[model samples]
Every structure is written in structure tokens, then in C-alpha cells.
Target chain A: MTDDIAVLGAGMHPWGKWGRRFVEYGVTAARSALSDAQLGWNDVQLVVGADTVRGGYPGHVAGAAFAQALGWQGARVTSVYAACASGAQAINTARAQILAGMADVALVVGADAAPKGFFAPAGGDRPDDPDWLRFRVLGATNPVYFGLYARRRMALYGDTPDDFAQVKVKNAAAGRANPHARYRKAVTAEEVAASPVVADPLRLLDICATSDGAAALVLSSMSFARRHGVDPVRIRAVSTVTPRYPRTTLDLPDFATDSAAVVAPPAIGFRASIAAAAYAEAGTGPADLDLAEVYDLSTALELEWYEDVGLCPAGEGVKLLREGATALGGRIPVNPSGGLASFGEAVPAQAISQVCELTWQLRGQAGGRQVAGARCGLSVNQGLFGHGSAVIAVR
Target chain B: MRTPVVAGWFNADDDPDGFRLLGTRCRMCGSVFFPRADAYCRNPSCAGSELDEVPLSRTGTVWSYTDGRYRPPAPYPGTPDAPWEPYTVVAVELAAERMVVLGQAAPGVTVADLAVGMAVEVVPGVLHQDAERTWTTWHWRPVGGPV
Candidate 1:
């Protein structure tokens, strides 16, 4: 145990285009998390907010925004932004404070109101900026990258579109049980094939959507949890790792793949590094993981995670999924509370939201969609730029 | 005007066909890098290392491929006056190096024709242009024939 930082409470304002200010969503989830912890906003000794690029500026300073929304009482405040991994980074920051005894209680919140259509790089004509150059020169969208992976799978392993569609079917069934998920009804493979093609070899169902939502967590010292009359599920480790040099593979919105200019990159992939850091810190391995919540931006990416996370050997991910090893009641179920497949990305709020799902499962509080014995759980997400996040939680 | 040969990235290209992507290997760690990291070694396990520049193989196998279906957003700097022309992107796996590299597919290639595992070679293509000069970049072309 890395000096268990108690999760006093977990909260969310659901996920979808609620059409409200992101601050409103954060405050709502904040109040809910505090109330669930049986503590008041006034009780938090520190505040950390995940930034979400407010129009014309980087997303608002979430710490002060939430503090002011809840009526500030002069708590230590911090703001962080790391694209998609902002939420997890926020949690990590809060954990550091509590573990260091700088504060006995803290609040962590992440919220975002995403823009429509494909995610675009910031507007500018800088030649050095690869994000803009890729889009301007090649016209690649996020789906285009997804399509490349899907096609590669077909070429290498003969993974049919039907195989990709089945991932949607399974995740949708789990999503139907998650009230917090945006798209709830069950999906079928035929339905997935019927959906319009967003990119070659990938369909609308294969890609996750952008959404507006907020999630918040109340974290505190173990002593603080005991003081609150709760023996809470604790966060064991938070992995916020970055990719090694020569990020050789192509990612979304980048013009040229990383140049192998100086030194060889890791044989272990970037995604694997996210999980490896968590497992090392949490003192656990894939064999000990009961459930895993990974960023499934595309179905192919999720299968890649299965291999990177060590749930299956490389080139055997499709085999693991087809054999029911990662299903609802299988040996090591994945995304038991639905997944990004059911809930489109809400950016800043997502990494924290993964923790919320793990917390629910670890406590045996996840009803209907519960894994039989989910004692230890892992959450994984990748941020744009160089950010990545993962968390390990235990009851 | 003859191209500047892009320095050490490729052999001095009097002909555009002479272009190839350049990379460096850590003399100390034996790790390879592309786009030519000239300053220092980046191996976490290696010391501030002496490096050697080496031209990468001109060919590899296609790992996967896709084509742009829509005009991309700005900062990509396509003028409002230019008609949007979609292009293909290919992820190529070099078995000798055991690494996957991505680049634009050569002109006229589309997703309909390219297959994974097909042999392809890297070649130079114009990235963009202004009144003064044209920017050069790398592209992958199908071997034998354009599919």
C-alpha cells in the first residue's frame, strides 16, 4: 500500500451534451462527492482542478472555479492541464498533498464541454508545429488513424470488420447497465456494420464521440477517512507517464511519424508504459487485475491495450476477446461498467471518470454490471501531446 | 535550383529519386533514431552518447493504410482558394529494424488499392509551397506498380 489515500467519495454529473457551462457540471459533481463523503465543501483543505481550455483561454482554473462555486474558504489551490490525462494528473497532485501531510483532505475535479466534429489542432501557421501540418498537408482526422490500425489488423491477422463490431456489441451491453453512460441501448454487430463509415475500415460505431460532462473525487489521508467514519476504498498508485523518445508510431493529427533520429525507442510501446508504471507502484501485475478500464478511443486501440497491459500476448488480443476472456464474467473482465465505447470522451473529465468506475467495482457497489470479484482494478487513458495516465485502486 | 540535399538526411540529391530518410544510431548503445537526432543520444540507459548518421532503407512493407475523406481544419494552411484534395497515409513496418514508420502515400494511391503487407519504398514529395520555395517531405510508393 502506497500509504492509502482514501477516496472519501466519487461523483459525476453524468456524461453527454448537457449544454451547460462546464463549471456548472463540476460544481454539481463536487457537491455530490462531498455529500457522499459526509463532508462539506468547507472541510476540504486543498483544491486541484483539471483545466479544460475555456474559450479564448486554456480551460478555466478548475481549482479556483470550483472553490468559488462552492464559496471559497481559502483552500490551497492548483490548476493543471495535460490534454486528456488532466483528470488523472489532478488526482495524482491531490494524492501527493495528502500523502505528504500538507493537507488532510482535498478535492479533485475535471470537467469539459468539447467542441463538435473531429478534434483539430490549435489554429496557427507555424511550420514547426506538427499537429497543424499533418491536417493541413495530409487531411488526416482522428478516424483516419483509427482506420489505419483497423486495416493493419486486417492485413496482419485477418481481423474482419465483424470482429471489431463485436467489441461494440459487448461494451454496449455493459453500457446499458451504467446510468452515467451517454449511449445506453444495446448495439449489435449488424447495426455497427450498418453505421456510416467514418474512415476506411472503421465505422461510426467503431469511433467514440465527444461529450460534455464532469466528474469529481474527494481524496483524503487515511486518518481523515477514519475521522469521517468510513473505511474507504483507497488509491494505491497513480501512473502519469510520458512516451520515450522517437515516439516512432504515428498518432492522430501528426504529420510525420516520430523520427528515429537519436536513440532507439522502447521495445515496450507507449501504452504499455502507462500500465507498467502503475503495476510497479501498486505492487501488482496483470494476473492480479480483476477489471481494467482503458481508453478505447477506437476498438483497435482497446485491443492494443489488452496486449500492452499484459492481459494477453502480442498478436493474441483478438483471440482473447473472441474467447470471452475479457467479458462480463470472464477470467479478467475489461470495462465491466461499460466503457468509452458507450460514453464518448469528455476530455479532461475522462481519466478521473475511469477511477470512478474502478471505485464502484472495487466496492462491489456496481450493480447489475458488477464483476463477480473485482477486488483490485486498473484505469488507463492516453493524453494528446505527451501525457498518459493510469490508476490502481484497492478495497 | 538544386535542392540543398537536406544535409545529412539523404545523399546529395541532384535527382529527386536519390532521396532517402536519414537516421542516427547511438555509437554507445546501438539504438537507432530517425529524422536525424544530431545533438545527443536519448537512450535512458546510455550516457550522453556519440552518434552516427545512417541512411535508412528506402523500402519496407506496408503495415496499414487509410485516405483522408474530408478537408482538414486550418493551421494545416490549405488556402481557401485551393480545392481540397485528399491523400493517402501509410504505416510501414521495416522488418529489419523491427519498427513501424508512417508517411504520406505517393500521389494517386488510395485506400481502395493499397493492401497491408505490400512492399513499398520511400521517396521524396513536395510538402507545401510558397512564392520563394517548396518544402520537401517523404512519401511511400507501392513497389512493382501502383495498385
Candidate 2:
């Protein structure tokens, strides 16, 4: 409820296929963040790293990997995996440490040296895994679910293909100003339309690409921040909540949706669940957001995020887009960091990167893409396997 | 093949001729769940109550369709030695239950012939094979189109 932890530094390894080890990228970013905070790795009492399953060995137990990479000094190590939300969990872990007085200063890191082509699950025959069942049985890639949600919006709310394209266009323009963004060239709706359709109603460009990258943050208690003569933007709340069962609206990798027959589903959908937790903890609503950095895996998803974040009503998402309510100069700007729409998928680093964008924006340091006079910010992203990660920050 | 009642609804001893989708209906709330939620009712508004197995209507409208141009990973039971052949996936909205069910389409049915809102029916098929048996699953087929 209180804004107590100070975010002293945020840094990222530019997202793209560098063919380097994930540990290398994370160490680079961690050192950059440490330098940004004018501290040494030894001063960091805790280090948290987001795990990337696709990157093999070191990725699975990322906390220790990064700690070893940074030349371990016995910082407490913990590894938590929640698919894409791994980075947020890492951040949450470090926040808990600083908040509980477990440690005065903590380092959080997430990095991924991604595989080429479509993302896949670890090799195994585990019927217990729903993600595996969907791929083996339905071949439903993540984008397939995104397409389904997009088309469902069209069926229920009259969202057009053009409406979806506009999200990419806006984000692409903003991405041009982002030095760390993988795709820096501005894109047009026509370019989006002309791109090959990977899934019906969504094109190659409509979906974020696969990239190898890393992101890290330095967090500390208020006392630690002042002791170093370093000022920090404060982190007000972090939401690592999960969905209530009867997750009726179809989610990725589920063969059949949770039947509302067993019980009435929650009034809010999964993304709303993420934002709701942040709002409750921060004691603020969507109207209070100066800027937001959301997980825009696909263009249509950005629109869905608009409604889920409560910037607009459920079916009125496209209407909000149409009127520029979510654009750069709009009343409540969304994905002003250019979003995942331009950054591609880096798995573990993506969510942490969302926070990095906000930390920069909150400090008035996000030069070209800065949300004008921003004071409050939030990052909203849903991880696979029901983990909802949202963080609210205020200056 | 010993098929799971859940797997049977989508890809198992798929009796093609009498192809019926399976689901669970809450006796208390009259709401339905695809892939069958036999344990409980999903409507949070309804007090947790009894559930009954129900056959979903064989016919539903196409909500959307797409193909995985790339091969999906493990737990799907495909062999890397074999050249990857992509398959189409469909999401159908059952008007009867107001739910969207997802499944693979019958082999060879491309996205070319499918359109949103077109009527389709559920049929059964092989999901994967082992030395001993074929794992069955359900496939959605467009009515009057190629099988």
C-alpha cells in the first residue's frame, strides 16, 4: 500500500538475435544497471533472474546463473518460473526482499537467447502439461489464440482488421524512437496488411518476432537509495496474481474453455484480473495512469489490453483506438514504449523490459517517446499458466 | 485405442458417422463447458453445484480458423525424423451452449475453404500413434466440404 522501494536503475541488452549466451546478455545488463546506480555487484544483497526455458541449461535456474556470471558473492538465490511472467516474478522476489528487510538492495535480471521460428515447449511427453496437449492435439500456436481473441472481438464488438492494423502502426512509429527496440523502422497500416498472414486475420508483422535479449533492474529500500546519494523512482505495487477458476473465456493452449456450467465465471477476464490487482494494491484506477507499457504480443492484443486495463469498455476497444484515446498524444496513452509489437518476444526479459520502459518514462528520461509530463505508470502482462503480472509505479 | 472421454470428443475411436461433441452441463445453472467439466459448474454466479455429462450439438458456426505453418513441439507426439506437414486448427462457436470449442480440422482441410460463420460439424480422428495403438482425437469438418 505504501510506495517504499526505490528503483535506482534499469537497463536492457538491445533485443535481437545476437547468437550469444543468455547469461552473457544478462551480465551485461546487470553491470549496466549497477553502474547506472553507481553501485557494485557485491553491494547487491539479492539478485533475481527470469528463466528462459528455450535457452537450455543455465536458463532454467537463472538466479544462480546470473549470480555466478556476476562473480557470485553469496547473494541469496531463488528461481521461479511462470512462462513469460518469469521476469516479473524475479522482480517481485527482489521487491519482497527489500520490503521485508530480507535485504537492503537487490538486483533483478531476465535474459533469453531465443530459438528461431515458433516457440515450443520443452521436449517431453507430459499429459499433465496443458501447453503440450494443445500443441500436440490442436497445433494452436500462441498467435492462433491471439487470432481467435481478435476474431471473437470482431464477432462480438465489430473490431475490424484495419482497427487491428492501426495498433501496429502506432507502436511501430513509437518504436522508431526506441534505441533498444528490435524493429526501429516505422511501419504503416498498409505494410501490416501486405505482410503474409501467419494466422487468418493477422499477418507476420502483426505479431511480434522472436529475439534474443536481456533486461535487468536495480531495486533497493528508500534508506539504501539515500545512503548512496542516488535518487530513485518509487515502485508502488506489484501484482503477481492468478485467475479465479472457471476461466471461461478461452486462453492459449487450452483444448476446451473452463465451463461456466460448473460456476459463473468472474465478471473480469484474465487481463482485467491483472490490472484489477494492481489497481487495488495501488489504490488507483485506469484514469490515474499517465502511461502504460503492456505486453502487445500481437496487434489485436493491444486493443484487448485497452479494455482489460479499463481504459475503455469491453467491446468499445476499437472505438477507443479510432478516437486516438490510446495514441501517443491521447488522453491515456498505452504502449508508449513501442510495446512488444516492435520489440518481438524475448520470453523472460519481456515483462522486465516493460518495467524498464516505465522507469525511464517516470524519470522523464525516455527522450523521444516520453509520455508528456508523466507522473504515474503501470506495466500489464499475462504470463502463461495463469500468472498475471502487473506493477504500478508513481513519482 | 483406449481413448479418454475428453480426447474422444476431439481426436479418438472417432465414430465419424455419429460424430457428437462432448461437454458438461451444470444441473443447477444450465451452463455448459466444452471438453467436459464433469466435476463442477463454471458459472461463478451459480453456487457450486452438480454437473452432468452432455453431448454438445454436432453442428456449430466457425468462429475462426488458422494453420500452424511451423511444426509444434513435444507432448504433441510428432517425430522430428518426419518432414513437418502443417495442419489447420479451428475454433467453433456452439450456438446451443454459447461456448467456443477448439480442435484440429480433418486432414487436408486448408483455411482456403473455411470462412467465419460457416456451419461445421465435429468428427473424430487419430491424434498420434505408437507401436501398439493410435491415440484418437476430434476434428472439425465443414459441412458438404472434402473429408
Candidate 3:
């Protein structure tokens, strides 16, 4: 497709609790990506940085911050913030610029230095902010929402805690070989069961942790890749879609779902629509996918994504998991890079890291966790508020 | 001594029969918003500026439920001085409004005690108490269960 852009290189700073500034991690990732592309700093015409709220004022202007840290080459810069989807937004912006001929070569970077324990909202007495109100009013931490979804699945589809624990076990086994993943040990179902419950039905090991990490990608116009005499992985589509009105689903930071009384609900739910738009743009479906990197904020959410991404029918996600249809050497592998189950969450850096995993897998460079004959991969994640994104990459 | 944790969320007075969550309904589109949409109607198709405050339906089916095993972080009003206690949370779907509202489960209602599609009703309860005031909030309880 004419809209496609070549992914020249992808890189990441290993996820962990490094206790460093967000900028430092970003710079490390950017330099590694540039080197992988076999290009110097001056070769990059644009720099797009995914913003991190925890980084103070510099985080807000991340584009300029990264450019400055990389020793300003006068590269045109842009910064975007959409919570967890920030990295995907950065990638989308870079792809758009490359296709529009605004820049022949672009670098997209995202990184975060997260705090310990649960992520709290910004300091304030402002009652107008829904994020703050959820904490103050209901004490609804992110895990609470995860627990709600997990329990609902159990009630509706007969999913058990064992099924949820199996997801962690599979992902952790894959993560054991991934150098960029934070937790590299193979986790057992027994280990997951032994972990304390953070939220009812969701144990400590079943939920993703918050960590410090960074990811970067070097993208170029297809023509630019041709000039370099390289046939690289190309980004087929990036869908950053918002939910339609009368959102019936109760998502994060909100205490209620929209009323479907007046306006009828959308034909497809929000998460389903995200991947549908990408499939429509890429002219491909789940059958064509070699691998997927769905956001596993909680083990249960990964099963939900299997349904949302059209890998299987609704209420059949657990069945797919039970049959090993989603494990490595199965019909289709998910989170071959171990996903958030191993890497934890660095917020802004997360979505970009998914793309990085896709790049490595498609290039056949993913070591022990490689999916056989991987030709195309998809990455999907949902952010706070209404932001959701899915990217498809093909070799 | 009872003050609402967040003002205007519910009718916090001591009348149990009259206790109901307040929300706004759009005049032009009939769209309802809880936590009150006082500024303007949120419906994109409707240009009507009037949003009337209305009390929501008290009873609804349990869409889902969960409980916190650990105390939440700051702005949640928990202190190290007092031992932490886990609390159950419930999301109830109102038939009249065609929406789901979330609140704490009434004291003693655990995740093991609830199931999906079980009917529950909103009731007034205390969230936390400081030296001077007992913070008031809404809780959901099974319709025929303990008071």
C-alpha cells in the first residue's frame, strides 16, 4: 500500500526499576535505534516523543527534550500524550509524516521512569478531574477494574482462576529468553496461585507491575528504504481510534458507563472496533496474522483481547487458551516478547515496545521466543480515557 | 457529623428511604449522565443547553463486582495509624437509565456473596471518618439482604 512506511530499525532499553530520569532512558533507546538503522544523528529529519506525565514539564515537551538530549540537529519535533497509547500515537505521527513527504526519515521515542506501588493521580483537590475522583471517592485502583473484568468473565463464560494463572505462566516462559523483558524467569501456575491477591480474583503475579523502560523506532519513507538497498519490515497500518458515544463499557478512571437510553450503542464494542479498523486498513484479518502482542495489563485482559482482536469468538477465549491455540508452536502465538506480563508497564514506552517486538520477530531475530515463519504481527493496546490503538506490521 | 466525601454526588441527608444518587438528563436527547453533567448536554447530536437534575433509579442488576485486598494509595483517606480493611466494589446496571453506576458494596458484602445479574439497590453509608467529620458516600446492597 502507498500509505505504508518502512521500519528501518527498532530498539529498547531493558525494562526494570532503574530509578533514572525518563530522558536518559529515551536517549539510550534513540541512539540504539539510530545505530541499528546504520544512520547518524543528522540523518533523522523528525523526532516524535511520547510524553510521560511523571516527568514534570520536560515530559510534557518530550519531543524537544529528546532532540536536545541527542544534541540538537535542528530536527523538526513533535510530542504526544495519550496515557498508555502515547507510544502508539508517536509511531502513528511518525508514519504520517513519512508518508506525507514531510520527512524522509523519522525517529519515534517513548520512555518512562515509573513510581513504586500503585500509580496515583496527580496531586490536586480538583474535584472536576475524574481520575482523581475515582481514587478519592471509591479507592478504585487499576487492579480493581481488572478484578471486576476477571470475575465477570468467570460468571459469564465459566473462566476460572487457573485459566488466568496459565496466561502468566505462558508469558513468563516466553519472557525468560527475552533480554529486554524485566522478569525473565519462567513462572509456574503454582507460583501465581501462591502470590497474594491485590484485588479479589487477581493475584499479585496475575497483574502487571509498573517499571522504568524505553523504546525507540526509526522509520523512513519506502523510497528512502529502497535507496538504502534494504527490504525491511514495513508498517501496514496504525489505528488510533476513540470509542463511539454511549460507551456502554465501564473503563478506567470512570465510575459509570454511558447511558444507551437515547442514542443506540455502536455495532461493535470499543476494544473490538480498534482492531477492526486496523484490519480494514491493512486489508488483512486475524487468519493472516503470524503473531500478536495484545496488552495484558491483567492476565484476564489478555484473554479478552483474543476475542476483541477476532482471534476467536466471544466467550471462547478461554477455550482457545485451553487448547494452546495462542501459545508458541500453536495456531497463533500472542505476546511472543512476553508482553506486559514480563515487562511490567512503563506507560509511554509500552506501545512502542510492542512494535519493537514485532520488528524483531518479523526479522527472524527474536532468539528463543521466535514464532516460526512469522511474516506479519499486530500490536494492540488501550489507554486511559478513550484512547486505543492497534498497529500491523508486515515483512 | 456526616459530610459527603465529594459534595453533590448524592443526597447525603439521613433519610434512608429518600437516599438516591443525583444525575442530569438531557432535555433534547433524553441522555442521562451520573456524577452530574451540570454544564451542558454531552450528546453530540443534541444542541440543547438545558440539563435537568434528576434522581436515578435506586435498584439495578449487578453487572459485576470485585474487592480490594490491599489498601489503596493516597487521596483514598486510609492512614497507617489505623489497620487497613478490604472493601468490596460493585457496578450496577440501571434498567431505566440503561447505564451502569459503580459504588462500594455495603459493609459485610464480599465478592463471594455476590453474583452477576443479582439485583442491588443504592444506600447511604460512611466512607471514612476523621476527628471531626464522618465522610458520607453511597453503597450498593442486595435488595432483600441485610440492612
Candidate 4:
């Protein structure tokens, strides 16, 4: 459990629709990270790229593609895809390599040029694929699932639409201070109520948008960090666990959940298990975390994450939000970098971006959105299908 | 002629009891799966490969519901010329199987008409129609509502 990797540098290209290739964004972020680490591209011995399905043939082999874009320095390359958890997996792969003594210095990168409107599955008729079948058969877009969760919250926890809108208001205020954020203007609750409904019980403003963005990290072995004369923030743990069988809760891209007729469901849900695994490995719990960056795909989902991350008991996420415990400068600030609400979703780049925010905060480098005296931070997100990821970083 | 959007999902032919959603139950462990787990039992503890086809519960309580206010992207087989109409989707918790199944609500049942824990029953309905065939799919209607 002592195999922690040092984060020497972190960087991101400002997230937005630049109408450019994802490789360009990735290269910019990588160059920035290399410069921040004071190491040239040739100095790194390994590189990992998070794959994006939208990026044609080169995207399929993103590791070699980004390496080629960075002028091919003969670095060992690997590409990984785990839907939205692609970035965390890429980071985990690098951490594994560094801890195993296979590499001294490694770079991890994830970038995406998202499609306009609701994200649909790759084309063609395939009834076997659940991702495709959900859209084709039920017309259940991603927002549909978000709306379902929101409504379920309202029913079970007495959460109101106004409570959901308050999440947008708070995150937008934080986004205004983040130069890297796409939407920098603070939003009013009225605006959220006025926004057209994309799915019932959730307005367009409640949901995160699709965008093109990139994030990168330069990681090194602890010994390498000490020799390089850098006091680096270290990644204590990366949890990339899958859901246990008979997953009771309904997740995205699935028509139905696994039946629990024969066996009882797990005591803790899949989302909770993600953070629990990370905390166990890091030897820290929710109380030890100074801040967190969770995937806020929708305003309601943000409230859900408050509970999922164990900031509060189940069905009491809204109470935490109401008490301002999750806002910036609160008891434990969540998503000080504006989260997906302001940054939108860059998919593969998002989980890495969360870690980047943590790194900057832990190092006291976050200009305006800094959480005061942040010592430890955790980033949690779940990908499409069963990929659940959580990473804890300590200064 | 009538056709199913996806074959073997549910019963399409007319029946008085209405169409029941089809699934598979593990013969060894008694675990049930929807969309038909033809290959193997998904339970981690059970190594049962003999899955038998079975009909799912017709009536269940609504776990949650939502409406799609936007036109979903392609592979959904929507006609561009026609005006888009929002439809309500419901996730119903089948008590017997101890699982939640999601499906479109019966035509004319808006989000206003649905609530969590309301009783709903599965029934066969038309999804869309082409010149040759009328694509059939399952719809969830509140039990004791208009047939």
C-alpha cells in the first residue's frame, strides 16, 4: 500500500469547442505539462493516451498517435478505453508502470472532440449492444437517465427542482473564477427554471453539455521526484473497481437491472464502493478529504454524488447542499474547478481534469478557485457500462 | 403486417392478458434476467448455464419516470418530416423478480399522469410503422387505466 506515485506536473487546455482536432488539444496540454515539469518530451520514458471513439482511425491507437504528434521520442506507448473512466485508467496504467519499476517518468493524456447534442452510440444496427439498443429501442438518451435519477430523488428524498438548480448556481459561481472553464458567468436559479426542458424534471441548464477539451499529467517515481528537486503532490491511490453482480441500481445504457432473486444486493452501492476502495487504499476516509471533484453530469447527479462520496448519509445530499457544506469555502468544497456543469463533459479528459484540479489545489497553485490549505483531495467519476473510478491525492 | 422492433423482447401477438416482457431464469440459482440472458446466469456465486425462457411480471410499481423532450438521434427510426412529440418513459420495479425494468409509457400518459410507486402493467404497442410492417414494442400503462 506504500506504492504511491509523485505527480510532478499537471496541465489542461482550456475546455471549449475549439473546432480543432483532439490531438491538438492533447499536444498543447502535454507540452504545458512537460514545461511545468521542466522536462522535455524526450525526457519521459513512457506515455499513455486515453482513447476516444469519435476520433477516427488514429484515435483507436491514441497512445502512438499522441506520441507521433509529440515527435516520436521512442517512448513506450499504451492506449486505454473505459468510456468516461478512460482518463483514470490511463493514469492508473502509468502509476502501475512507475510502481512496478518499469519506468522512471511517464505522461498520461486524455482529450476529446465531442459530438453536438445528445451523445449517441456509434452507427449501424446492432441489437446485441446495450448502448445502441437503449437509443434504438427506447429512445432513452443520457438525459433520460439523468431525469430518472432526479425524479427518483424527488420521490425518495423530497428533493426539489429548486434544490437541483441551486447546484447549478453554486457551480457556475465557481466556474466564473476558473479561466479554464467554458461557462465563466454565474447563473441564477431563475435561469435554470426558465431553461427549456431537455428531459422532464431536469432543464437544459441542469445537464452538462458536450465539448472538446484535453487534460494531461506528468508523473514520476518518488525517487525521481526527489532527485529532480521538486516537492510533488503524490497520488496515494487509484480505484478502478467494477460493480458487483446483480447491480440493483439502474445505470446508463441498460434496459433493466440484474435480478436479485437468488442473492441479496451489496450493502453499499456501486458509486459508494468506488470511493470506499480508494479510501481503503489511501488509508483515508471522507473526513480526511479537504475537497472533492465528482462527476456532475446533471444538477441532481451532483447532489447524488454528495451522498455517494459519503459526504452525508444516503438520501440527504440536498441537505448538505442547502447547508452550503459542498460549495466553495464550505466545510468540504466539491468541484472547485466548476465541474462538468461549467466545463461540460470532455469525456476521456474529464477524470484527468478532476485530478489536475486536485493537484493544483494541493500545491496552492489554483489562482482564484483555491480551497484554503487543502491537504488531500479525491476525484470520483463513473464511466459508461461498469467502469467506476476514484483517485485520492495527498500533499 | 406487424413486426417487433427487436425480436424476442416481448410477445407481440394479441392476447387477452396483454404482452408480458420476456426474460430468462437460471435453473440452478433461480436468478432472473431481462432482455433474455440466453447464454449463462450472471450471478457470481452460481455457475448455472441452463437458463430457461420465462415471462416477466405483467404488473409492477413505478420506481421512477421521465420524459424525453428532445428528438433522440438516429437508429431510433424517427421520421424527420413529422413533428416531434415527447414521450414518457417509466422504470417499473417488478416485485416478484426484484428488478426494475424500463420501458416507454403507453401513448397519452404524460409525466403528469405518472408517479413513483404507482401500479403499472406492460402491454404490447406499436413503435412506428413503415409501408410493409408496423413495428411493435412494449409499453407500460398504469394498471386499471383505459385499454
Please state the Cα-based DockQ of model 4 relative to the true two-chain complex: 0.90
Better of 1 and 2 by TM-score: 2
lDDT by candidate, in order shown? 0.81, 0.82, 0.93, 0.92
Worst 10 residues of 4 chain A by lDDT: A55-64
Candidate 3 docks with a DockQ of 0.86
TM-score for all models, in order of appearance: 0.89, 0.89, 0.98, 0.99
Q: List candidate 3 stretches off by more than 4 Å.
A: A56-60
Model 2 chain A, poorest ten-residue lDDT window? Answer: A256-265
lDDT pick, better of 2 and 3: 3
Residues A153-264 of candidate 4: C-alpha lDDT, one tens digit per residue: 9999999999999999999999999988999999999999999999889999999999999999999999999999988999999999999987999999999988987799
lDDT of 3 by residue, B10-113 (tens): 89557988999999988888899997897788887888788888999989999999998887887898685688789999989999999999999999999888
- Runs in model 4 with CA error above 4 Å? A56-60, B16-18
Native-to-model Cα distance after best TM-score fit, residue A393 in candidate 4, in Å? 0.3
List, for all models, the DockQ compared with the true complex.
0.38, 0.45, 0.86, 0.90
- The worst-scoring run of ten residues by lDDT in candidate 3 chain A lies at A52-61
| Highest TM-score model number | 4
Predictions ranked by lDDT, top down?
3, 4, 2, 1
